[model samples]
Target: MTLEAYNLLGWKSETVNLSFPDEDSWRLDAILYEVDSQKSFYWLLFTGGSISIYLLIYFIQKDSLLKAIRKSRLLFTILFPILLIYIDVNRIEELIHLSL
Candidate 1:
């Protein structure tokens, strides 16, 4: 579905399917925000944490992800959630992460 969406939009995308380490933030986020994955992945890009990963997004409606970026465009909105995200795509293990 994601690949098809990108193809239709004339965009090139390669997805990585790595387990999000031992973090718990994103999971709780999914429940908290009631996000619909059909359109977004709840981007959570924090900039610090060394041993764990966390996720955070505040949307549920389809296409709300794009809408958020359109309005904010802050570093916090894009690849920062999984858009699923956190800060510094390079050092994903360096931020305030949530875990169970």
Candidate 2:
């Protein structure tokens, strides 16, 4: 699925295998390089905006920071699964549209 997505996005990706000097387990890393710079720039901008908002909220609600943090965590726990489902559904919709 990941490879398919990378191919769809016209990105260059490679899988690398690494072994630790002392450990027996080997690790496989999928490196995706040569990504679209415009997408990367937009993602960085969105992440920065999210962090700025979080910091602003933390500072403004300093006295209730802990409470706010707890609430945020709870909200994330509740929303994350739904968000994942929505993303997956959107992906499937896109795939179906492409196939048709």
Error of 2 at 51 (Å): 27
Estimate the TM-score of every prediction: 0.20, 0.29
RMSD of 2: 14.8
- Give the candidate number with the greatest lDDT: 2
lDDT of 1 by residue, 9-100 (tens): 76856542333344654644443343233224422233321112222133223346666444444444444454443222222322222221
Clashing pairs in 2: none
* TM-score, cand. 2 vs. native: 0.29
Please, what are the lDDT tens digits per residue for candidate 2 over residues 1-100?
2323444366856533333333312211112222233345446545655665576587657647666656445445435544554554465445434433
List clash counts for every candidate, in order. 20, 0
Candidate 2 residue spans exceeding 4 A from truth:
1-72
lDDT of each: 0.35, 0.45
Task: TM-score for candidate 1, please give it.
Answer: 0.20
